[model samples]
Target: MVHKEVADHIRSWRFIVLLALIVLTFITSMYVSLRNIKPAVSNISDPDHLFLYLKLLTTTDNTIPPFHVFISFLGPLLGISLGFDAINAEKNNGTLIRLMAQPVYRDNLLLSKFTGAMVIIATLFISLCLLMLGGGLLLTGVRIEPQELLRIATFIVFTIVYVSFWLALAILLSIQFKQAATSALTAIGVWLFFTVFYPIVVNLVIRAFLPDPSFLSRDEIAGYNEMILNILRVAPGQLYADATTTLLMPSVRSLGPLTMEQLAGAIPTPLPFKESLLIVWPQVSGLLAATVVCFAFSYYLFMRREIRS
Candidate 1:
């Protein structure tokens, strides 16, 4: 069943379009990053070039943002596109009923759909990462260090989990809504809200509550900023962004606002791979929890849902 679903996704036009857009964005970002990397590399010493390859993968040029930025933006779209119709389309075509009639369990069927989608997504991301690494190596001639490779590997895993959360959400929507169009639009609307409008809305709410920032003390202002950052982290997009930023740019030491005392005696150097992971572990856990909750809800609802042609 998993194999069949995987093949179906591969042949689908939606998959084709999503893959094309991602590949195009990645190539464009890499091209722009490579162009600006030369000057930066020339200024840095050889010994200090640790994780330079990783930097190339994520450094933004004048026009284009980093490749990981593109991933953070488009990853949800890929998930939503693949999963919005997973079960509803089966039911629409009268296949869900037929498939359920076979010896296969309903749980297995739903799991197959999710697993198949995950497999495809993982393969696509791994391939893209390898491609980006190759391109970075060829263009910059910087060798990837062991620590850099570990960080990149962790980034890929985090990305998969982050995208899987959307995939699970779309699957849950697909189970709840009988119409494919309804599920698709609802998924896209949720994505747009979290990605584009959520930050604006957050700022407005924070302003309404805090009124004037000038009236607040330094410590109070720092508290407010920390509170706002925490509120934004509730969104999965923000969590992914924070995690990727920490992972890709090891120079990032904290996710929240840091005070002068906290910054005192801090070395201006990239963190080791383990330290980077420790910094983003909470974000990673959040993404994992979100994914599990969505999938569990879908599984429960799917099992209880009345199936009819």
Candidate 2:
């Protein structure tokens, strides 16, 4: 069943289009980063060029944003496209009922859809990372450090989990809505809300609450800023951005606003791989929890759903 689903997705036009968009964005972003590679390396003082490879992915030129930024914005689209019709399409074509009539368990059927989609997503991300590494080395003539390569590997893993959250959400919508079009539009609507409008709305709300920051004390203003930052982190996009920033930019020591005391003796240096992972562990856990919740709810609903049609 997983094999059949994988083959079907490979042949699907939706998959083809999404894959093309990712590839185009990735190549464009890498090209932009490569153009600025000289500045990126020269600005740093590390003898080993510890993050030369990471700079390739995170540094941006005038034309395009960083590769991680592109993934943060568009990765959910791939998940939604792959999963928005997973169950409803099967039911719409009458194949779902036929498949259920076989000896296969319902658990197996739903699990197959998610597993197949994940396999495809993982393969796409791995290939893109390798492509960026090869291009970065060839274009810049720099060697990647062992730690830097580990950070890239970690980023790819985080990306997979981040995207899987959306995939699960889309599948849950598919389970809830009988029409594929309905599920697809609803998923995209949610994505747009989080990706584009959510930040605007958050800022507006914060402004309404603190219209006169000048009236507040310094500590009060700092508190308000921290509060606003926390509110923004409610969006998955923000969480992914924070996590990826910490991973890709070794100089990022903390995700939150730092006090003067905390920065008093701080040196400007990249963090070790272990410390970077520690900083982003909460964000990673949140993403994983959200993904599991969506999938579990979808599984429950799918099992209880009536399939007369």
Candidate 3:
């Protein structure tokens, strides 16, 4: 019974649409990145656009092209959308009672739901990443080695963690709201607040509170600017970005000098993978724990609620 429910959920049209969207976005990103490469410098007869491309790719941010930024923002939103009604919808359809009457344990239902959603997320995330890797190899003609593969694997795992955070939030909302639509809307609202509006609000507050003094020189103005930014670093986006930098970048001599340009320049290092893991292990674990906590709270609400027709 549990397996059937999971399979039916996975086979829904929503899953197909989500999968298609993921692939389309992934392809678009690769196409744009490859198409936008500047002409290579003339040198010896042997020209390596692939190596030059990857090197240049990580060395700087694309001011005109912002696909990477979109991925970072959209990944979590996708997770939340998929999960916002995992439970509430079943309840609404009068299927929850039917399922609970089966031989399967109550625990199996919840576990299978989470597992199914995760399977979908993982599939799309890995597919997009592999597409990026395949495109890189095709353009550069460079063979991927064990180390490079390791970096990609770690990055994919991080993406899963990031998405899981939003999924957990969705589950919590679904349990709190009886209606699926309301749960979804609430989840999206929270997503926008944290991912979009919250940062803008923080910036406005910072500007209002710490305005640049008209009397100050350029250096003083820079100091004031840095002060405001440092204060804003307390925001969730800043913390997540910091954790991502520590995980993805090879070396970080100082976090103080971080700017948009600096982050773009910071590429994955060839350092011991475990060392990078140790640095960001806390963040990775913290996010996963938060996800678990959110779901646990949902479980409490869900188990205690009275179901009615």
Candidate 4:
């Protein structure tokens, strides 16, 4: 079942279009990164700027956003396209009824499709990373350090996890809505909400409660900033941006507000990989929890659903 689903996705027109967009983005962003890297590197005195390979992902030329930014926006759309019709379209075409009529268990059927989508996502990203690295090597003539490679690999894995949460949500919508179009639009609507409007809405709400710096003590102002940061982190986009940035750019020392005392003796150096992971563990955990919740809810709904034409 997983194999069949994988093959179908590869052959689907949606997959082909999304793949083109992703590759195009890769070319554009990397070209910009490679073209300007030398001058940018020469000018910047930041210690972490020594990670030239990482800059391939994090650098921007004031035209296109970097590779990571493209992924953050496109990743959810890819997941949604693959999953928004996973159940409903099959049902509309009578495939779900026919498949359920077989000896296969519903659990196996549903879970297999999810696994297939994930397999495709993982493969797509791993291949893209390798391709990007090869291109970076050719263009820059720089040897990738072991740690830089590991950080890129970690960033890819986090991206998969981040995207899977959207996939699960799309699947849940598919099961909820009978029409595939309805599911797809609803999923896209959710995506736009989080990606575009949710942050604005959250910020407006936070401003209502924002402590005035004039009245608040220094520690109190710091505490308010920390609280506001946590509120913003509730959006998956924020969580993903924070996590991926920490992974790709090692100079990010903290995910939240820190007091002057916390920064008093701190040196501006790239964090150890272990420390970087530790800093973003909460964001990682939040993403995983969201994925699990959405997938589990969809599984429950799917298991009890009555298959019909």
Candidate 5:
């Protein structure tokens, strides 16, 4: 019964539609990036600016492209939309009771739904990633470095966990909210709070606390900004961005911003990518763990909910 429910859920159009959108986004991003790229020019167009152009095309420069930003910002919205009605819709249609009448257990039903949704999510995420890689090869004809490919794969996996956080939140709300629309809206509102409104609120709080303009020195002001960001970094988006910078930019040792001269001085002597990964692994692990913790809480909430007949 559990397997059947998982299979039927995967066959649904909602899952298929998300898969299509993921592929479409992958193609669109690659096409636009390839189209916009300028041919490599040897003549110095501002020696300072030359590195920026090279970084854009290089594998390690993980600056969020259009495809990346879409996945980071909008992927969670899709997850929430798919899951917000997972429970409530069935209850509304009177199918909940009918399903319960079968020999299946409630734990099996809930577990199957969550597992199936995650399977579809992982499939869509990986498909989009591979599609982007193929498109990049066809358009630019550039061979992707193995390390770069691994970094991209890591980014995609992290993205799935990030989106799953919102999906879990939606499932938790669905258990609480009874009405599908209300559950969906609540999930979106929470998304907005984490993605948009929370940052604004944090800025406001910082500004209010540091009202005097000339009270702090340059170093003190930098310290204040760091403090604000540290507090706000509790959000998954911020954590992901921090982790991504470490993955994409080999020079990012500390989160502190440095001038070009300072950056040059601080560059590792041997510049081994493994060293870079070692430096950033803790940050990456933290973000992944936080994502799992959020979903685990949701699972606990879901299992405890009373689905009234």
Candidate 6:
């Protein structure tokens, strides 16, 4: 059942469009990185010393956004596209009720759909990462260090979870809305609200309620920034940005404001991989919790839903 669902997803035109868009964005980012990388590499004494290969993923030429930024924007779209029709289309066409009439259980069917979509999403991302690594190696001759690979692997896993949260949310929408179009639009609407309007609304609310930080003492300003940041992190994009920024940029020591005392003897160097993960663990957990909650709700709704032949 999972295999059949996977094949169906792979054969869909929507998958083709997603692949094209992602690959185009990847190539554009890669080109920008390659163009700006030579100068950066020449400036360093040891070009391939540490996270050199990561430069391909994190490096940017100002005008074009880096690779992960593109993923943050487009990844949800891919998830929503795959899951928005997971149940409704089949039910609308009279196939879902019939399929349930057969030997397969409802839980198995839903799990298969989720797994199949995730498999395709995972495969596409892994392929792109490999392509980036290979292309970067060929062009710059910078060997990928062990730490770089670990960081990339961790980044890929976090991304898959982040995207899966959207998928689960989309599936929940699909279960609630009878029409596939309604579910798809609803999912996209939620995405747009969080992505575009939420930040503006947050700023307006904060300005109206909170005092100006410039007038506050140093300790008060730190508290103020942390408060705003916690509010912003409610949005999934902010959570993702926080986690990914920590993962990709090892030099980022803290997510929040640091005091003069804390920065007094701080060295300007990359953090250990485990330390990076520790710093962003909360954001990662938030994404994971969101994904699980969305999936659980969808599962319950589908199990209790009444479908007629």
> Against the hidden true structure, what lDDT does model 1 obtain?
0.88
**lDDT of predicted model 6:** 0.89
The lDDT values for all models are: 0.88, 0.89, 0.65, 0.90, 0.67, 0.89
Native-structure RMSD, model 1: 1.8
Q: After superposition, how far is residue 144 of candidate 6 from its true place, in Å?
A: 1.3
Q: With candidate 1 superimposed using the best TM-score fit, by how many Å does residue 113's alpha carbon deviate from the native?
A: 0.3
Model 1 scores worst on lDDT over the 10 consecutive residues at: 41-50
Q: Give per-residue CA lDDT, model 3, range 153-230, as digits (tens).
A: 776787787787788888888878888889888987877777777778877877787655887765666677777656
Sorted on lDDT, best first, the list reads: 4, 6, 2, 1, 5, 3
Backbone clash pairs for candidate 4 read none
lDDT of 4 by residue, 106-164 (tens): 88988988999999999999998999899888877889999998899999989999989
- Give per-model CA RMSD: 1.8, 1.7, 5.4, 1.3, 4.4, 1.8
Report the C-alpha lDDT of model 1 over 58-156, residue by residue, as the tens digit.
Answer: 666557778888888899999998899998999999988899889999899989999999999999999988998888778667677888888888889
Highest-lDDT candidate: 4
Q: TM-score, each model?
A: 0.96, 0.95, 0.76, 0.97, 0.80, 0.96
- The candidate with the higher lDDT, 2 or 6, is 6
Screening candidate 3 with a backbone cut-off below 3 angstroms (N, C-alpha, C), the clashing residue pairs are 50-140
Tens-digit lDDT string for candidate 6 (1-309): 989989998899998899899999999998988898776566554333257677778888789899999999999999999999999999999999789889999999999999999999999989999998888889878678788899999999999998999999999999999999999999999999999999999888986887876688888878877888899899998999899888888888999998788899877788889999999999999999999999999999999999985
Put down candidate 5 lDDT per residue, 1-309, tens digits, no spaces: 546655765677866776677667666655555554543223244221222222333322234365666666768776786688878888888988888888977767777767777777777778766766776667656677766666666776777777777777777778778899999888888778888999999998789979575976666777787788778887777776766666555445677544455566553432245765776666567766765665676667666766666
Q: Of the candidates numbered 3 and 6, which has the greater TM-score value?
A: 6
Clashing pairs in 6: none
Ranking by TM-score: 4, 6, 1, 2, 5, 3
